[model samples]
Target: MGHVPTRLLSHPCATRSPPMKERKAIESWLTDMDGVLVHEGEPVPGAPEFVNRMKESGKPFLILTNNSIYTPRDLQARLYRMGFDVDENSIWTAALATAQFLADQRPGGTAYVIGEAGLTTAMHAAGYILTEFEPDYVVLGETRTYSFEAITKAIRLISAGSRFICTNPDATGPSNEGLLPAAGSVAAMISQATGVKPYFVGKPNPMMMRSALNAIGAHSETTAMIGDRMDTDVLCGLEAGLETILVLTGISSRLESETYPYRPSRIINSVADLIDEI
Candidate 1:
């Protein structure tokens, strides 16, 4: 919605580095959907080219999104609506990863969800029974209609000793207007109610990264996790033993990197810069 920050490209960090070292075997890329490729529903600059270049080069890639609110089909349609030609199978959300984990842990068990239809649908499709009754697991994600009643129910089940699992830890997502509560907000509420920490299974979590790599059939050594969020995207890549590339076109600022222990393997201003480098 605003001008693309120029400092992201011409920042002091860029001058010190002799251009990004050539991309290491990056045969496959695991990319974040929201901030890395698009923002507030619009493709970031050079996003189409970046994706098309990968397609042209015959390198495989998948959109690894932490947002569990949307399914692969939903995301594919959204990308198409945004003018990007993306394959549906190339999309993987925290919802899918979380569902896979839950299915393995407690197959067919009832799950109490505090998120959107996508989370519920994925879990159900994965053979987990969806119920508002006392569930074995209380899963949390992005629920736009996250009301007091929903939180109350989730807290009740969690306090009753149900295993609490969160899709992600992101507190906010960008909008055309401003930032809004994300999946992590619901997770925080449940944690306060249950006095227990949730097992996060999204970006920054190796499980999510592992699932993406497995789906793309790429080795961690040859995989790249590209995103704009430092705490989630870059950190997840670092955890997965993959190369972490930080694009400043979204939430994180260059100065903020000094505060986190999760240092990115490389930092670029935007996906456009990545295109420029390639």
Candidate 2:
């Protein structure tokens, strides 16, 4: 991780080129879950205070995550345990976004799914039939256990002509044991076998950002996306035309962000620094 510059710490709003009124148009916010708010299932320092400030300010915001293993209710409960008081409605996951995409593209379609309750439940709620017999789509999502047999079945199904879809493109995820192969890694294996690339609906795709903004009834021009990773959060927010803030509390660092061609609208030490802005 790169060290945050002292200049950014001294002037939090220095990056905003727009005038005061235009800057004040930023009434909504979207934030990454893992690195921005929590680290390894624990709340980041001052994360709770920042969250409470958002609520008190009455600004529309959503806590976004690419992890598709857990539902909003599950995440809400987890955050509650971590000392943050976020409501389930204010949480959005890749699973929900994927389901929304499928429903829009192929309503009431059948799918062969390889995911846990979060993904499956959303698909079912969208009126999708989950099956293995010539399904309309082959959906992949994160799971605690990835079964070889399931992957084999997915490969066969995709080879047989089902459209391929994945929740996110994360190749690996952090775990207590260490880094573990995630949905993107497994998706690559399946893609290699069937010669078909799965369409990822998560961050860095920009679709996730658009969907999240719509969920909160926020306009991109008036919304700011706060994230830890430049490739995913900042990239997607930029693509979606939202102001992007990279907080140095997770994966990407201040120096690492410079390596990228694009730049965030602002950089802050952490979510802690944004409480005053709220």
Candidate 3:
């Protein structure tokens, strides 16, 4: 299992590599983590095999997540416990994308961040100073505890000329008890108070996909994006010029997908349907 599938390679005699036209249309993959692979702390049916097949195909791939509360290593451990085998380097988060974006825009910048270790650590690695005194940006990300004081501070900082930036535009996040106010909901409040709109840096914004492509050294033309939602995942993949494959294991239903102005390249029942293609 650790080696590339034998069929992919050409044997000197009887067995030959697939002809150019017979080769997989997709050369690389970028897939959403939550709905496509797991749901409610459980691995989706055939999700683990799909991931393993992608790895065995000897293709470049990365697992993407909008949740910024956990770092790549943390998520890797979480997924490992849940039965998925993936390296930490194969994981990508909104926090990492946001940090990459900020680093490109202003290298050695300062920010007043309100989030957990994921966001703060990414900022630090990008050489961004986490401060409240005339910072360059007011960065916001997912957090288990969103204090009023932090929101108030972010509001004040944005009011005084700091640019507003959010990890993703999700208004609410899922929880065991119920829906919890996420970064987007708090961003709405801060925007209402200060009249400053935030620049979102996650799915539904193609920049994040582009960054992921660059991170994996893949080209959009040959890369395929596997996601479950038509709104964010599929839409972003479309905008990023990659082939989008939407699965029905999560949010968007086949009936719901018809309503979107743009459509995914293909829609399938689950990742199980895609294992052979990889």
Candidate 4:
């Protein structure tokens, strides 16, 4: 992560001038999980405080993640271990968003799922039957161990007329060993085989942001989106009509942000800086 320039704090988009009521309109928040809250299973500075403040303020908020390997309970426990007291209900995942999309599109449809517990559990909850034989869709999600056989099955299923859907567009994920191929990479392989591009239902896609907003019962115009990645979090937030805050605590840097056509509403060093605002 890079240092956020001080000038960015006073940028026009960073904060509304004068009328306190205008600033108070932003009562709810939607934040990316990995970069904004934690890194490598560790809590980012002041993340716990930020969350606690939101909870105490009686404002609705959600921790959003593109990673679909873990369920919300799983994430809650992980964050708890990192000393952040976030409830399971306060988390929104790509898995949940994808499942919601599927349920809305075809209410009781079957699907062949390729992912871990998070993805499977969401689909099952959404009333989607898991099957490999003539299913309605082929859903792809993040997993620690992606089997080649499963990929082959997904390719075949798509070729057999099943719609292709992916939880997120992240091509790689970090691990102790290094970077590993993630959901997007696997989706690419399947697309090459079946000549069908998957409809990604995660970050950088406004649908994901809208779903999260709905989960928290917050309207986009009155909510704030906090994230570290400009390409996904900031871009999606802007598209979803939410105020975007870019924190330089993960993949994006202050310098690189200038190159993007869309800019975040605010740029802070980390989630720590958000405590005073809350």
Off by over 4 Å in 4: 1-24
Model 2 residue 249 CA deviation in Å: 0.6
The C-alpha stretches of model 2 lying farther than 4 A from their native spots are: 1-24
TM value for model 4: 0.91
The lDDT for every candidate, in the order shown, is 0.83, 0.94, 0.93, 0.92
How far in Å is the alpha carbon of 19 misplaced in model 1?
18
TM-score, cand. 2: 0.91
Cα misplacement distance, residue 95 of candidate 2 (Å): 0.2
| Per-residue lDDT of model 3, residues 1-278, tens digit only | 58865665655444755553332478999999999999989999999999899889889999999999999999999999888999999999999999999999999999999999999999999999999999999999999999999999999999999999999999999989989999899899999999999999999999999999999999998999999999899999999999999999999999999998999888999999988988
Residues 162-182, model 4: lDDT tens digits:
999999999999999999999
lDDT winner between candidates 1 and 2: 2
lDDT against true structure, model 2: 0.94
Model 2 per-residue lDDT tens digits across residues 140-259: 999989999999999999998999999999999999999999999999999999999999999989999999988989999889999999999999999999999999999999999999
RMSD of each: 9.7, 7.9, 11.4, 7.9
- Span of ten consecutive residues with least summed lDDT in model 1: 14-23
* 10 residues in a row with least lDDT, candidate 4: 15-24
lDDT of 2 at 69: 92
Report how far residue 99 has shifted in candidate 2, in Å. 0.1
Clashes of each: 1, 0, 0, 0
What's the lDDT of the predicted structure labeled candidate 3?
0.93
Residue 83 CA displacement from its true place in model 1, Å:
1.9
